[model samples]
Target: MPSVEAGTAGPLTALSPIRLEFAQKAFIVSGGRLLLVRKSASDPFHPGRWEVPGGRLEVEDDLDLDDHIRREVWEEVGLKIDPGPPFHLWQWFMPDRADLAGRGQVRVVATARRCRPVTVDATLENQESDDHLDGCAWVPLDEAGTYDLIPSLRPVMRAFLLAAG
Candidate 1:
């Protein structure tokens, strides 16, 4: 569980010497609350679990890391946010029998604040992917643990709450 603090200018040099691929996620916070999404049970990867909004890098569409975060947050939750500097970085490794085994990933976790009033619409629940997201909500930071969040997110959430406080 290697976690990088906010505002890192370069990769996690201390954890690993090997070059690794990168991904990004946003712990979107608003008014002392955090946004979390529920994965569809029909999906394979941690289905029915809670997670922050994010996705793998789209080299073809996203021009850079910040662009990817902006696009993914909107596409996943229909919220406009001003993503702050990355708050944490997780070195991800799937089990040998896992679908994404052998390959590793570095998740650049950033904090963001809502820029506009969230517009509730049908599109928010209707995810475009087959098994990506099913539902989402803004939970109070203190109460976020009641939901079954993704395992890696628990520590990140704790660190974030402490830092924000």
Candidate 2:
């Protein structure tokens, strides 16, 4: 009989798997302005705060990462975007909620892709009534600091501004 070590690759499974949720964000920039969406007041996370347009990946969707981002942008802000390669990456653990039932906080890993509007005159609109977004704006990149943005995204915004300058 062979003894399996707990830390070895042999059949000793004692550790729980770490699950991370994947999400994508678009830094949609047009004419020196960045597109932002305001989360609804009742939103679970970052209520009434502004953030770039994007969302988590859906397992049911057959689209690739770029197309998923495009769909999210369209559904959230009614804009067609040409997504570029990811420019920034960030992750955050979800705050504890009653609904989680002691399952531990969910960790979300997100990528921020630089994107451009497909049309010069494309108008921004919140397409879904039940979507968490309540408002949209094309704020000048230099002036974005004045807005109430999501706290976790402050560093990313700062880096973007610094890089733009």
Candidate 3:
């Protein structure tokens, strides 16, 4: 990731006025299978849907994006990854309840990175009491599309499969 120094003139400077949230998702692969986690039934956004491990970047996190992703992966699924460069990028706008009094929706920009697990052991430990993730599996890459994934992730899965082939 590149940063713009304060007062520097560039095309990205125009984005200063907009509030964008950054998030990272990992496609952790091992033994021709991809990891997926099921969102809890009570999750407001996409309950019961399957998604890759990762989450939004918090302001308090380390400046390094890779480190931030590593932390999120560990926290979400109890696994370590060697994150590769982002293979896909996507964004969506949703109502921002925190800023409902002012702006109605906030744009969430996210990157889906290709990753490899540090070890062949793909056993997942999802702490149900701590987060919305309730279950996990290492699905074969060719059979991934049959699972009910979040809407935004469908194309990502297709692209990944094609690329992996």
User: Which candidate comes out best when scored by TM-score?
Assistant: 3
RMSD of each: 9.1, 4.4, 6.9
Determine which window of 10 residues in candidate 1 has minimal summed lDDT.
113-122
Clashing pairs in 1: none
The whole-model C-alpha lDDT of candidate 2 against the native structure comes to: 0.78
TM-score of 1: 0.69
Candidate 1: stretches off by over 4 Å: 1-20, 95-126
Residue-level lDDT tens digits of model 1 in 39-142? 88886667889977777667788997777877777788876666677766665543332234444334343343223224433146434674378888888988
Per-residue alpha-carbon lDDT of candidate 3 for residues 144-163, written as tens digits (9 for 90 to 100): 88999999888988888889
Could you tell me every candidate's TM-score relative to the true structure?
0.69, 0.80, 0.81
Query: Candidate 3, after superposition: displacement of residue 160 in Å?
Result: 0.7
Instruction: Please report the candidate that would top lDDT against the real structure.
Output: 3
lDDT of 1 at 152: 72
